[model samples]
Target: MGTKKYRRDTLIEAGLLFSLFYLPGYLFLAGIPDPRSFNSLLYNLQIWILLVPQIFMVIYLMHRDDLLDFQSFGLVRPGAKDIPFILLAAAGTAAVVMAVQVTIMLVAGEVLPEEPLWKLTKYSMIAPVFISSLLTGYSEELFFRSYLYTRLEVLDTEKWSRLIFVNILFAAGHLYEGVPGGFNAFILGCYFSFLFTRKKNIHIPAILHGLYNFSALLLTLFL
Candidate 1:
């Protein structure tokens, strides 16, 4: 009975991770995180409310169940040798931004951001940008590449097959981004998966993922 309960709980937690990734979009679709009201503190607070709780739940459950740890979760501190790889990831992210820009131009012609791109670096947005980037970087990497990756590794499936399957879900989570964005995310997902496995340290991927995302937001919004 305990075994059955454990399996059931695991299944539910898996579903939660997928849901958490996609839930923030509902706010925009439902017009709850209304862009029109973004200047108001209340509107801004709504954004945080929508984003935070589910993520915290994932962390709490993972910790409580003893399913996560610094190493298993890819929270290891990097060795000096890892510096170049991390830096390379940052540089590669810039290239990815350029590629995505070209792809967006070709596919969508002009995919306007919900928020003003020009205002991304504004003083008011500094806090939001930092908070959102930090949350996205830390949470998504921990949930997807770290937790999901570790669980999937235990499956009898072939290695590449498992990685590809996970990448598809990761890309699909960003489906609201349109075809180009999804494609970009798919490629990025695959790359990060490869990095995570090869390095056996999620810190590099986390750093790379965070910087990639933060830069992608800026370049996508501005350039």
Candidate 2:
């Protein structure tokens, strides 16, 4: 038999996780007009810094309690057979997201905000955008998909409820983006979550997330 679940503490742990790490980080960066501000960068680096330890904590807690293993959490080391599938998942998901984003753009005919995101023009931002996208993609996916999904598993939430609620929370956490960003995040969360549930691999979702982010960065040229 497996270790007993911590069913009662599910919501408590979720609240604590958000309040302790994400909430403070969001508040710290709230007033910054530009995402590249000293404050914003600090917020970015700080959250990821906190996230590393938190990742370890979640892994340790789950493993110690026998609730998770490398395989269950999709932390398995990719062997020879997994690489191509992973690459295909990432590339295919990126293509789909690009098409969706472009459709949204066309439907709304919205003007791209001046100084959106990194404040670097398309030609000048290759390296910075790549770095930012990778970091955000990896960190967010690890937290939301890998860790939070596990947390939800111990709750009373049903399968569909778990899926919808998790995606909703993911969108809510993207509050920095205001309305449009929240919408985009919700859609991306659903897409990535679908992939995660299907593949049972965090790496798949993370790779796709990163690729999508990088492609979105490239899209800045036209926006």
Candidate 3:
């Protein structure tokens, strides 16, 4: 009976965490008139800014439950050894994203639309883009990769099942950017999951995720 109650509590906590992290995205999707425009970028930044308090609350709850530690979440101070893994994770993300696009093109004969997925209408938007990338890198990884994955492990979920389950939601969360964006996000989500699992370091994956976003924004700016 105690075991049953514990499992129920775990499930409840995980669900609450998930909703807390993602509910705003769903609620605010309707507000962006053009997803590629400068205004859209600012809107995303605002969402992250507003989420600061909620993020702190979520962290506090996770700590209170003793669900994670500094090492578990890769919150420790880094050394030079960590740099290579960070770069590799970022490169792996790019490779996976490209591979997915190529596979879709070859199999379905339809090109995934890129314009709607990333664009910046003005040069002045660069600073906000960087800020958005930084926030996205750490925040999303905290929720999607570290917290959700840890909870699933506690639930005794199968490894592959956990990967697929988390990435599906990760992808779904990006559906506001359109189907292509969601598809890319799904693939990259899988890559980042693998990185975190192998390295036992969320910080590396977070930095990699940030680099990828920053690169995408730069590509839109120059190319």
Candidate 4:
């Protein structure tokens, strides 16, 4: 009876997270006429506003459930032993993202346009880039890998279904980057999810995520 109740509760929590958190953002992006043309600063600010509340909500929910510990979220303090793995994952992810863009450019026979995020590099706008990247990185890892994934596990969700559900939403969120970007995100999601499942640690992927976004913004400064 307790087992059944736990399963039911986990299912409810998973449903709520998907509906309240992921679906809204996906729908918002889908509803946008031209997200590319949207004001970068405004977009950055809007994201920060959205993410702050969402992060707090995650914290609140986890605390309420007494699942607020770092391990519960698949997070841990990085040690020297973990540095190489994190670096390798970050590099691999970066390579894959670049490879996709390069392949698309070569096939299209034209240079790809600048990323919308690159617009945030102006000194005055720079802070948002770092903050948003950091927030997005940890928040996404927390939500997808630690929270939703664990909830689904408790509910005995099918392995394939869990993978597809978590990754599709993640990839969908990157659709503003266009098809190539979405595809790239899906590939990275698989890697991060697998890593989290294997190591029970979210910091590697989270740090890599932030670094990837930070590097993108930093590129704008150099170029």
Best by lDDT: 3
- What TM-score do all the candidates reach, one by one? 0.71, 0.76, 0.84, 0.79
Output the number of the TM-score-best candidate. 3
Task: Give the per-residue Cα lDDT of candidate 3 at 146.
Answer: 78
In candidate 3, stretches whose alpha carbon ends up further than 4 angstroms from where it belongs are 1-3, 27-33, 36-45
Local accuracy of candidate 4 as per-residue lDDT tens digits, 32-87: 24423223668778878988888777766766663346576665667888888887
The TM-score that candidate 1 achieves is 0.71
**What is the C-alpha local distance difference test score of each model?**
0.65, 0.66, 0.74, 0.73
lDDT of 2: 0.66
What does each candidate score in C-alpha RMSD? 4.5, 3.9, 2.9, 3.5
What's the ranking of the predictions by lDDT, best on top?
3, 4, 2, 1
In terms of lDDT, which candidate is stronger, 2 or 3? Answer: 3
Q: Which stretches in model 2 have alpha-carbon errors above 4 Å? A: 1-5, 26-50, 121-132, 218-223
Who is ahead in TM-score, 1 or 2? 2
Candidate 3: tens digits of C-alpha lDDT, residues 1-223: 1266767887888787777667776677634356475436558668577656655765666676554565665456767999886776667777787898897788668665634455776787778777777777888887888777877776788999999999998888777766766787898888889888887777888788877888777777788
Clashes of 3: 0
